[model samples]
Target: MKTALTELVGIRHPVVQTGMGWVAGPRLVSATAEAGGLGILASATMTYDELAAAIKEVKSRTSEPFGVNLRADAEDAARRVELLITEEVRVASFALAPKKDMIARLKDNNVLVVPSVGAARHAEKVAGWGADAVIVQGGEGGGHTGGVATTLLLPSVLDAVDIPVVAAGGFFDGRGLAAALAYGAAGVAMGTRFLLTRESTVPDEIKQAYLARDLNGTVVTRKVDGMPHRVLRTELVDALESAGPVSGLARAARNAAKFRKLTGLSWRSLATEGLRMKRGGDRTWSQVLMAANTPMLLRAGLVEGDRSAGVLASGQVVGLLDDLPAVGDLIETIVADATGILRRLASE
Candidate 1:
């Protein structure tokens, strides 16, 4: 399982448990790290103080190296970057492409920067900006995503970037991992796959719901905000889809205010972030305010165990997941299965 990712990040397996908001906490991160996989704590949903505490908590739980996924657009992104440098984290992962200056600062401190991208162009952008590695997720992934499927996106990114590329989106098993490697990827990154694992903090009832789904169970819609997000087709999702943009925006605004209050984001900071989102051309002011709503909405279903009012951000792979094994067991199973698959393919 040794590859550039494992060697660079000092993990035993090439598999990575990516940061999922309100899901990838210290317990899960430590568990993944202990199992020889790279575990990343999702800091996008956390306050600066919370992120700092979580980082320390992970360090106390496991001596193994793990990463922290941060929102590059957060106003305090610079402060968060300093916290990561101060903690000497093994790898710094970004939900979006970090600024060149931020990447330079981490590199200067001898930290590995691996930003997650949804397209080949983004992969090239981050790599050119001096990122040590990149995780390319395709359209089938959970949360914010692009339109290209993994089969097309992974190779496109691999061909475009010289740095190690970790393939994500619709990857859940050893066969998927093997396929990524065959496509010339360094390894595989997973979100929905790990979300259904025993290590995840998602509730049992919700996890069961995810397991019952099949490839056709999930749907991609812009109703979640304005971006094309893939999620399980629940009643709430259907409502949002049918409500049109006005109604959705109203709900999004309420959720945004709630999230702002919960996370202690000031109106000024919220407005500033909104402006950045607008300038990015990926979303509008209304959509930007609603962007903060997603984490809380997801938390309601994932953490509070309420699926009716909460939105569960998921990949199409959720339908394929049937069991919830311990993190250690899951990692070992993936490695063994991948090894067997690779060997069998070689024999053929």
Candidate 2:
């Protein structure tokens, strides 16, 4: 189970429980850490104070190494970086590639930087900027994702960067881990698989809903946030796809306001963040406003357990998952299974 990722983050297993929003809180993270895998706390959905408290809670629950996933483009990105440094977090994983100086600042403080990348060039960019490693997620990943499959995308990134690459997207079992390692990846990162675990705080009904899916149960649509997002094919998702642009924008505006209120952000600050997103991605004003819909909608489904009202972000791997094992049992099984597979191949 030992690999560059294990050595890089000081974890015993090469598996990683992704920092999934609403699901990767202290309870889930601590369980994953106790299981000897890197458990990343998802900070994108939390306020600064909440993140600090969650980090403290994780430390209280387990002393094993873990990471925090951050939104590098957020208005408080720098402040959050400082929080990680002050908290002595072992690793910092970014949803978006952070500025070079941010990478330098984190590295200087001895925090390992690992950003999720969708393409080989992005892996190279972050690697050149001193990222300790990169997690390359493919089109099958949940939420906002690219259009490339991991089988193709993983090798391209491995070829493009010398740093340790963790393969993500469409991975759920020990066999997938063995395949990723065979493909030259240091390890594997999984979001949906971890989300379906027993330690996950997601409501049992929601977990059942995810487990009820098949191979064709998920759909990738841009209606979620003006970007290609993979999610379970729910009635709400179908409605969103069929709705007109004007209606979509109206709903997005309302959600944006709600999100602002929940986060205690000023209207001016929200607008500024929207503008930054627009400029950075060359997105339309409508698309920028639509982007605001993600957090609130996800919160409704994941946190509030409103299946009819909220959209569930999910990877297509949901079809293959049926049981909810405890985090410790899941990781132990994956490690043992992968070891047997690799050893058998070597003996052959």
lDDT per model vs. reference: 0.88, 0.92
Model 2, residue 51: C-alpha shift (Å): 0.3
Q: What are the TM-scores, per candidate, against the unseen true structure?
A: 0.97, 0.98
State the local distance difference test value for candidate 2: 0.92
Candidate 2 wrongly placed segments (more than 4 Å): none
Number of backbone-clashing residue pairs for each candidate, in the order shown? 1, 0
Best by lDDT: 2
Summarize candidate 1's per-residue lDDT along 1-348 as a digit string, tens digits.
Answer: 888889889999999999999899999999999999999999988889999999999999999999999888887889988999999998999988999999999999988999998777888889999999999998988888888999998999998999999999988888888898899988899988888888788899989988988888888878776788888899998898888677777888888888887777888998888787799796766677677768778889988989898888889888778889898998888888998999998999
Q: Write the per-residue lDDT of candidate 2 for residues 198-217, one digit (tens) a residue.
A: 89999988999999999999
* Poorest 10 consecutive residues by lDDT, candidate 2: 261-270
Task: TM-score for candidate 1, please give it.
Answer: 0.97
